[model samples]
Target chain A: MSREHQKYRAPDALDHTRELLGKLAREVSVSDWHLVIEVRPDDLPEVALRLRDDETLSCKYISCIIGVDYVDWMEALYLLRSQEHAIPVRLRVRLDRERPEIPSVTYIWSGANWHEREAYDFFGIRFIGHPDLRRILTREDYDTHPMKKDAWPHRVRRTEWRWEDIERPKRLPGETDRRDRS
Target chain B: MSTVESKNDAVNPGSPVNQDGPAKPSFHLEEMILNMGPQHPSTHGVLRLVLHLDGELVVSVEPVLGYLHRGFEKLAESRTYLQYMAMISRLDYLSGFFMEWGYVRSIEALMGVRAPKRAEYIRVIIGELNRIMSHHVAIGDFMLNLGAVTPFFWVFRDREDAMDLVEMVTGQRMMYNYLRVGGVRWDLPDEFEAGCRKFIKEFPAKIDEYEELISDNEIFISRTLGMGIIKPYEALDYGISGPNARASGIDWDLRREVGYSVYPEFDFDVPLGQHGDCFDRYKCRIEEMRQSVRIIEQALDSICGGPVNIKLPPMIRPPAGEAYRAVETPRGEFGVYIVSNGGLRPWRLKLRDPTFSAISMIPKLTAGNKIADLVAIVGSLDLLMGGVDR
Candidate 1:
């Protein structure tokens, strides 16, 4: 590996990032993969802008936007990478499960447009200022947010016609109803 | 749908019924909406492009995907880490090993296990060979899209030799579940080195023949020279990677940038292009194949015999932590992000497919260009819907 890469390593590489985000973010934690910072949903746009424009950070590339449903709340993780420092950081915003909404960072990084849409498609986490927040990986009329823990898998086909709606044959005097069998 | 039509009709008010009388006959040039395949041949897979056109010039292009969405991520949530291996190879069918490598590496990192030096070298060699194979298909299909049929045949014919060599070691042709968590599934076969050496020695001349046949052709040059130009900043902004990003004069390659696996020891150049145009993208892939060959030769010379796989329990339960590993797949930076909750199955596994970002830029690139140029631009991007949709 190059000397510069060896110099930064992982722990110290994002030390400055931790320091910078400490002022703007609610919490900062380092993981094996990246430096994670927790930000409020309302502060996501401003925090994302600073991470991209701040000279010390310069995280211009938005690698991905991942949504995880923890049952109680939904979390949105923004994976950001800096071309200048070759360091990656993850900024996370926690949302209410009842009404998950956060401002979109499409203005800061154009790459996040599709990823945000994908998160919305599966998790139903609405992006406030998104240009077009429609279903990306699912059909337009798909009703359920399939990636949520409580949501059913999209492959399960649901029929509109119920068994009760079907006309039953005349039962014999001693015969039992099919519904009673269950 | 109604809103979109009304908006389009309002902006482009040139219907025949609304035209002013005889003497000033205005051209009724309403915007045309064209759907180019979930079934078209040149799309390479089930990808649909909804194109808005004004007379032959493309006004906008929206890529409609998910025709092949099998819910890989949701499936991963239910299966064990090892069980998910069966599906990883199918992510990018053209280059399966790299996807396997990315997934295995992430788990290995979380588990804190390291592959031996020899196994690392083997991984590098096979990975580079897969890279060459993928580029062959890409360049071939790209040429075919541009109306050159002969090069496609030649390229695929050359790729078969590499495929046979890989099959010899992996025991399968395409979906080689050859990579495990700590290392490869099996050691190299007796003749693996000899076969690789012979192929490496012969591949450069085939590349030269390809250049002679297509690179300098006047028609090909005009069609590609300045087409689909993505500036360096625009490419970075869109998070494009691999040859597409390199063609835009970015000196970023995960092999060199992050230096994962045994790639740092290999001395090879990351080929770059001056202009970020279609021609530059083609040239970059061709040059990258040469670099792959160079890396393979060095790995073959320095590789030593050792254990291929490390011992582990029947089920692998990585520690409760998140691990993200990125590898330089032929398409671009294929990364696997795994969040482990100390269980047999992953809590969340997100595949950051490079094609996802690369294809996202298609709409911007297709604007103001002729419909014919759309094919060249999309072909040069070398997107696989399998990877994008997954």
Candidate 2:
């Protein structure tokens, strides 16, 4: 009966002719329960800045920064909420799969530093201006970005425990892998 | 998995997590590095904090995580919708029901069906009890960090009674994988109402006892008051949620804000603190326990008779869409973001643990504080390594 009640509007997100967001929004759409404002990778910083400072759409609180790998392309979703309105906004930025890079919004929200590092650790996406862009969750020496779909080459949903399914580390140079015959 | 690093040389390789601070403490000439936990009890989980200290004062604290990472998110991509339900609770074991509730809420939202009225009320009832149970541990463990062993025992002793009530209904005390997509596993047993009512009735008195026992103590006041003050703006900037954020005067609670489940039907108050400090955090939690008791009593009074679960096909696949559903867990806003590609299994499932955001701010919060106060501050945050490491 009502479109206002149906689709979640993020301040002036849907309308692209207004001001700051209007000049930047590449593709404005709605997803699930959020006003999904798709912006260019380079424009992520500006878009985030306005989203935080704009009185109407003051999206100051960022809940999560999710990075998704679609095999062909990469997407970074920022879940934002405003305390004044409690309206949730999703800033979706598409990245090149070959060299997935996005301007970090860490400057806007300090909390995004750790989240950006986590995305960098998992998806191998680089945040251009991230001061501490090191891996947050995985060991720095670990080569594989485990969250990527291709990370697990031979991922078998093992129904029963198999001795071969378990990966064992090789013994140290001098330490022998002695096992009793029993 | 809790890797409590020793006094020095705790950094894994090349000192990855621990970077040198910008404003280095020049007074000491060299920052004395100290490692608190990957194994310390106060750490709560496998969390290693590499603290750079000048004498007894912490210059900068770097938290090293992933010691307890089990790759639960990757596991969800392979398992079907039903199969993944079993492990969601493991995301935050203290309030496993909330974890399960968050995941199932997204699935149910995607399918466009709410659980029957009775089922919702039952969830509210169980969820509040679980909140009290979790806060018990948070309070007890916080007291333990302050070196008060008696309050820890007191909270634990009462926690067992609350756990017994949950066990009677869910068949498990801690890891209650009892929440299904459309509704709960089963309706409340006949005796549960009487027992739960008794717990809620006595629960308020128990909360009062706890407040009287620990709240006014001089040691606790001195240790917590004006220590680790999280400015409201800073709290919002860091994405802190639940009691921690409320203690900082944010006033954002998903149960009240999102109105998920039957929370809107309840009559309760979300206690907020004026000063966002360690003491306020503890007080907010204690007040929340009382509010939980209020919700439980209301739910018990209004719970109606109906089927707890809805009928669904053996093999179910949600349409290709994305949904995010968060619940006001004891810890914070525990949200489950699910992306279904019209498959039996989800394409991607992100279990957002509130502890991740809380832990990210640890280095900022504990800096300049003495090592003893660092324990007090960290304890007040009520961080669980199981959730953060995930």
The candidate scoring highest on DockQ is 1
| Runs off by more than 4 Å, candidate 1 | A1-10, A13-15, A153-182, B1-22
Report per-candidate DockQ.
Answer: 0.41, 0.41
- Candidate 1: Cα lDDT at B41: 72
lDDT minimum window of 10 residues, candidate 1 chain A = A1-10
Tens digits of per-residue lDDT for model 2, A1-182: 12322334453555631455776888776556577788999888888898899887788888998888888898898998887776788888899988999988888999998989989998999999899999877888998889888887766545466766677887777775555132
* Docking band of candidate 2: acceptable
- TM-score of the B chain in each candidate versus the native B chain: 0.94, 0.92
**What docking class should model 1 receive?**
acceptable
TM-score of each: 0.90, 0.90
DockQ of 2: 0.41
Compared with the true structure, all predictions reach lDDT values of 0.88, 0.85
